[model samples]
Target: MKIIPQLLFVIAIVIFGYFFSKRVIRIRKNIQIGRKEDRSDQPAKRFRNMLLIAFGQKKMFKKPLPAVLHLFIYVGFLVINLEVLEFIIDGLLGTHRIFAPYLGGFYTFCLNFFEFLALAVVISCLVFLFRRNILKIPRFWQREMTSWPRLDANLILIIEILLMAAIFTMNATDQILQTRGAGYTATGRFFLSAQLIPLFEGASTAQLILGERVAWWAHIIGILGFAVYVTYSKHLHIFMAFPNTYYGNLNAPGQMWNMPEITNEVKIMLGAAGAEQNQVEAPARFGAKDVADLSRFNIMNAYACTECGRCTAECPANITGKKLSPRKIMMDVRDRVEEIGSSNSDEDGKSLLGDYITKEEIFACTSCNACVEACPVNIDPLSIILQLRRYTAMEESSSPADWNNMFSNIETNFAPWKFAASDRFNWSKE
Candidate 1:
């Protein structure tokens, strides 16, 4: 029986590791389907951004109430997961509470701290659920948030609450067993779990041990399951945020980037540089028409979106009842990416521009950076919008007639108005 459990524990670890690694590999491959660009400059600056935004969660504090709730869950989960280190050790060695003897008093302190955080996380999850279901925050009711998106949000919160409950229950039963001198290691007092001792008071030692074992197993298994589920959930941001914030566009949010390839072409055409000659097989697409045409950073941005609807809430277009929702844009990109990434059908030639995102939505953007600024994470829906817009304007020549007229005026008369060059200065004289 001892050998069977030890073998089973190793097998569990291997299976979890194998699936998690495979999902990670798939995500990387899907992200790599996009065009590449270097984000290597200013390493020190990127490090600061990663530290401040990802670690400190600087942007989230802009909204105090929800931010506080979010911080409770976010910080609490991270701190509480430290217990997994000890759990892993115990599982491998077939020992119970492996760190209790080694760390002595400090181990007790750590357990107390973990229980406190676990309680906070449970409370935070409950409050968030109330906000989503009862309070019905307007942003949460956006068109894109219906069906699966809404359920996904609620499901994650419920999972957190359950996971925390498992920890508290496990600790409570362990405390009961400790009093009976039941061979369970005493990790000292846990403030929150101590209050639950009454619930198990009439239980036999054998029954308490069974309950303790069940809760311990449930907590660990739930954690492993959560790891796999998150890759497919919006909660992937929990892992992606560090890298996403590190590669964030450090320039002003409102600042736009000219396509370097197009700029270089223009410069060469105007005889501005010593141009070499031919190119082998670089991608010929000038702007994104499909997921593959987008830059790697933009694709990553889709995955990093929290789908909190903060971006849509801040969007001028959305506020004005226009077709665009910046939040929806990110959601759609992620949905389409997942669809495409998982599809095996060769006939499935769907693309983001026409199939998922419409011209109306893309054109409705006012080019404002409200979405960029409002995002708690550094996801740039504008970049994705602009890239698709570029495809419409340049590759398809599908700009509106008025926009085409403006382009013609700029080309022929060097201004938005169709005026002769000589007459352009005539208005100035007046």
Candidate 2:
């Protein structure tokens, strides 16, 4: 029977690893399907950005109340997970409170700290749920947030609350067992957990043990399950945020990434470089007709988007009732990426261009920087929109009549207006 329990623990670990590894590999593969670009310049600056923006949640602080509330979940979840290492060890070795004897008082200090975080996480989650469900904040009801995105947010908060509750219950029952002179070993009373001691007071040894066991199992297992679930959920930003911020565009908002293929062609045409020097193997396509046509960073940005609607809320186009929603653009990129990654979804020959994101939506963009400035995670929705817009205009030659005339004027007269430079004096005389 002892051997059987050990075998089961090994099997559970293997199952979790298998699923987690598969999801990670799939995401990596999907990201790699995109075109490559060099974002390797300035490693030190990138590191600082990752630390300050992603780790510090600097942008979130602009909104004080929600930022503080979110900080609780961010810090609490991250800090509490350190205890998971001990939980993993204990589970494999069938040891209860494995670090109690080794660390002595320090273990108690750590547990107390974790208890405080756990309590904060629970309270924060409750408040988040209330803000989303009961209060029904306006930004939360944006068009992009109507269905799964809304439910996904609520579900994650509820799961976090339950996970925190299990941790508290586990510690509470362990404290009871310790005071009764049970063999559970004394790790010292955790402050927040101690408050719940009365609930299990006077319970039989068997009942207390069962409660402790259930809570312990629930927390560890729930954490493992959540680890797998994040890869599939919008909550993936938790893991992707660091690297996404590091590779994020550091250019001023108005400085767009020029299409290198187009740039090289232009250099050749202008005689700035000899055809041989400018000559490279032509790409199969230009701009972004699909997720694969986009750069790797853009696909990663899609995965990193928190879908907080800040982008949409700040978008001039969205506010004006245009077809464009910057938030929806990111969400559509992620959804189409998912479809492309799944078997046969790409077989229909439809893509992000006309199928998911419409031409009208792409045309509505005024090249304003509000969405980029408002994104807390530095997600570049405009880049995706412009890429799609480029494909629509340049590759497909489908620009609206007005835009086509503007393009013609710029190409012929070297300006957006149709006129000869010599003829400018006629207007000046008037």
Candidate 3:
């Protein structure tokens, strides 16, 4: 019956692996539903960008205090997970402190290092929770951050705190058991967790053993559960940020992508030389009205968004109290994609443009590209906004009355004024 616990550990690992893999595959499929566009150019530049933005978190440094706090949680959580590797090995072999005998002092040193990181992680989580709930940061309490978004952020912080507590409990109890001449291995004291040893001063050996076992099980199980839950949360940014940064747009901030088909047709009409070179078939639509019409990079951006509201915070239109919130645009796209991916019917009589994101929101954008500059992961909300604008103008011929007037003047007078092209230079005579 001793091996039964090992068997259960193996089974838990298998189930967690299966579900996580399934969720990842589903996300990939959903992202692929959008049209393909080549983002593979400039491998060196892309790699550098991924390193700076995702790994180094260069953009996050814009806000020094939050950035430092985030670094503590990010770096500490990752380092502590290294200890989980030991947990897996011990659980599988039904052994305790499996590496201690081999590494001696080094094993103890590693545990002490992890304890320090765990304390840092716990303290960071508490600060984040206080900021979100007690202080009520404006970005975290935005209209887009409804009940579920707020709850998800708080839950992740709380889970990290509890997981760190479990580690301290397990270490303290194990040390107590070792001193009692129980079967527990004699590892040296971990500096941070050692402070907790006094709490179990008079506990029986059997009780200490039970506490250690319970903590051991809880910590590993909680880590596994957190891994799966992150796949469904805004926390998916943890994994998606790397690839999203690698595939980020390399063009200048103000430069917009034009439809090749339209550009070619315009050249042909003007009888320009080499107009027919590299000519391709026209696309079925001018711009994106739904997720399928958007490029794959745009869809990936939707999933990579952490909903941190940096984009919205930098938006000129949002600052002026317009309906435009760049963060909301990305969130709306992700919600639409999820809805479509999970739907049974192909045509749901709803689209990302009209159903999820409204015309007023898209129209409110000034094409300033501030949101793109503000995004930590290089997500381009402006690209999505421009695509929706194209559909409104070219496909539906539904631009606002003022914009239509400007379009007419540009077509007839070759400028946004009523003066003919021949008289355009007349003002220079003055």
Model 1 scores worst on lDDT over the 10 consecutive residues at 274-283
Residue-level lDDT tens digits of model 1 in 302-384: 99987999999999989988889998888888777777778833147788989889999998998889999988879999999
Indicate the worst ten consecutive residues by lDDT in candidate 2: 273-282
TM-score of 3: 0.97
Error of 1 at 336 (Å): 2.0
Please, what are the lDDT tens digits per residue for candidate 2 over residues 268-336?
Answer: 678775555655666787778998899999999989987888888888888988878998888898888
Cα lDDT listed for each candidate: 0.87, 0.87, 0.91
lDDT of 3 by residue, 5-93 (tens): 99999999999989889888888988998999998799999999999999999999999988988998888877888888899999999
Candidate 2 residue runs with Cα over 4 Å from true position? 267-273, 425-430
Distance from true location, Cα of 413 in model 1, Å: 2.1
Candidate with the larger lDDT of 1 and 3 = 3
Model 2 residue 169 distance off true place after TM-score fit, in angstroms = 0.4
Model 1: residue 290 alpha-carbon error in angstroms: 0.4
